[model samples]
Target chain A: MDYIRVILTIFWKDILAERRTREILSAMLVFALVVILLFVFAFDLSPETRRNTAAGVIWVTLCFSGTIGLNRTLSVEKDRGGIDGLMLAPADRTALFFGKALTNWVYMLLTALFVVPIYSLFNNTNLFSFTLLGVIMLGTFGYIVTGTLLSSLSLQLRSREMLLPVLLFPVVIPLLLSAIRATSILLEGGSQTELNTWLVLLFSYDLIFLAISVMVFDKIIED
Target chain B: MRNSTKTSLMLIVVDILAASLILTALFMVFYYAPVEVEMGLVQKIFYFHVAAAWTGMLGFLVALAAGIGLLRSGNMKWDIAGVAGVEIGLVFISLSTIMGSIWARPIWNTWWTWDPRLSTALIMMLIYFAYLLLRNGVEEPGRRARFSAVYAIVGFVSVPLTFLSIRLFRTIHPVIIGSSDPAATGVFEMSTRMTHTFMISLVAFSVLFVALFWHRVRLGVKLALFEQRKMEDFTGED
Candidate 1:
């Protein structure tokens, strides 16, 4: 379908651009590393404390670094007038939203992929579980679904840099709370019963936000 | 001219009613309602605290409706209503949070807890604070209205989620009128007089919310007109 192609075209364009510049990924990765390092010195937790708190630390780092990637994802388009160019393309605007959100979601997952192993090695706690990774993916998807839409809105503002997180963080609290809880439960070796509610919360958040972002993205992008 | 006078007269009547009702509600809270035995006089904060929280939620619902209105009709009046609702919502939510904190200090023995209701209320406040900031960051009125309306629409999705997540996950905050939870530290059974006072206070605050929102919308309309006139003058000079 043309819609699928349009979405993929936008997605591939971002991929190609990032593959050439590597700007967003590099910044997000470095920011993730620094946040983790700062957490190390700030908390100075013992092994037991570290085990319990590792999930919180990782999610927080991902959230902070994820903001960087999101800011870049849209600001880059706005800075170069790429959004106007994309708008000129005869495609549904929702496709553009899906494309951008998908790209941001990928960037977030890639950052997590790198951050998780390094965090595990440094903290001496295994965080590479499938369940935790699943939570990260769902959480990151929900966050980016909202984030990409908000970043687009913020990019049109004078205070785009500061506005994105202010707009995004408060709205994403449900996703964050559920994600953190699920991750903590996995880290503590909790059974499925404890994780079920959180997983449902994350799924519902993703669905709700994805639907809203698609519906409202057109209004924000209008000239 | 006659229509303007009529509208102003209605507003004045509403203002007088709001004032008297608020005074009566305060009297009922202090003099009429039974003093709570467990927490003593400090428990009196619950009357206004709950009232303010309900008003804040009502304001947000108004904002959400106005947001949808703007998107549907593309009218600046709807945008004006949207901003007014958010502004008033922010004020009452902030009041509720602070009063809840003060009440918590004595009852829960801590100034703060990660109680679901309290945390969600704080998050709701932060979302609207961001809404205000988002509006400030735009200079163009039309674009600003569009962006803020869209943000309000998107932002409202969080309210229900925040409430549900808190209710589902864990809560130590008191559920005032519901099934008794033994773990809820602040649960209190209300006598008939107390219930009457609470209902009156809720009604009074709802009227206050409407009055404040109307005034704010009027101010927004005037500001928009003034800005348009200023732009026209600048264009004329050019």
Candidate 2:
């Protein structure tokens, strides 16, 4: 209960702060839209092809914008001297990990909420399936679960914004591959077995990395 | 610095051994092994190519252990080992990729394909390369080691998952160890002579990887010491 309360406090603080500025959320939304726009131009994302190409485009957009959101979320804390204050507080450090991850997870889902509709509208293809949205949600959860830790790890490094993506992209290749593939199957419709493979892979990824990050995150953020 | 000369002497001995073994393996690969029937001379690349890729993977595995060692012990010595393993891994893996690419050109009639093994090799390269870049991004030595160690573990764990996801898609890369894929372009069975050459190449590469790991660790130590001394001597002078 204490751990949960501490995590919620930090999560609440982040949400309140973000609500005021909406900087991270807005940035992610706009960036995601632009990436979709780029994909529209670069690839023939007509109604027929949208099923195959849109899955990758959407995930890539989420990843890139998610990177931006992750960097800023941490930098905002560092810039405001919130990190030292948080450290001094009488809370379990891992609570802070959950707090940050939870917040990023929200922002990422919010970004996805916006991108999916816009994509469906532009392509004239219905992407409003419950399963597709569920896949998006699951994939986003895994991405942020892994990204939150990495963004924190890379946060303290020089040229951190530049460093974050390079640090992150390789580590999440599996997650990205699974997410894109899973979404494609949901959109285009595929064999239940293949979908099961990717969804299980995605779930295991979320679980495995979430455990690893919680164990080691304190090392990165510790004084 | 006290044991620098002694260590250098050891490095020289191992270096000589590695060089000679590789030379013998090279001779056996070309001269002793029968010319591959289907691919002829081009198939010769398979020996060193696989060896380099194996050594590269061995280096990364060493780094994973070094990473764990550093986290558990808080020893910076393990940091040197971690960096050295990754550095050597990076070089060798990149060589393996290029060599594999060249082999693909003739054998697969394409410069590249996203077969599970090939893509996995590429992702492995990127992951370790990012490991090196992460090291460069942190100014504090202890923190850098800790961060990179964390990442090395993370990166190492993700690779197999990456492999599994891609493998599920379908692999056209040859599986020489197990049953080969029929759809795979360049599958081959090794004759006795070729197997002998391949085994020798593997041995040669293992020795070379170990020797290089030690040498790289030594060089890392020297570089760290030099940097520390230089930092100490600096007094904010122009």
lDDT per residue (tens digit) for residues B133-199 in model 2: 8888888788989998899888887455433533354667776766765677788898999999999
Candidate 1 has a DockQ of 0.83
User: How close to the true structure is residue A12 of candidate 1, measured as C-alpha lDDT?
Assistant: 96
Place model 2 in a CAPRI quality band. Answer: medium
lDDT at residue B149 of model 2 (Cα atoms): 89
Q: For model 1, what is the error of residue B155's alpha carbon versus the real structure, in angstroms, after optimal superposition? A: 1.9
DockQ of 2: 0.79
Alpha carbon deviation, residue A72, candidate 1 (Å): 1.3
Every model's DockQ, to 2 decimals?
0.83, 0.79
Q: What share of the true interface contacts does candidate 1 keep?
A: 0.82
Tens digit of per-residue lDDT, candidate 1, span A1-223: 9999999999999999999998999999999999999998888977888888888898999999999988998889988989889999898889889999889999999999999999899977667988788899999999999999998898889987888888999899878988998999998878797799889989998999888888788888889
Provide chain B TM-scores across all predictions. 0.95, 0.92
- Please state the i-RMS of candidate 1: 0.9
State the displacement of the C-alpha of residue B19, model 1, in Å, after optimal TM-score superposition.
Answer: 0.6
Task: Name every residue pair that clashes in candidate 1.
Answer: none
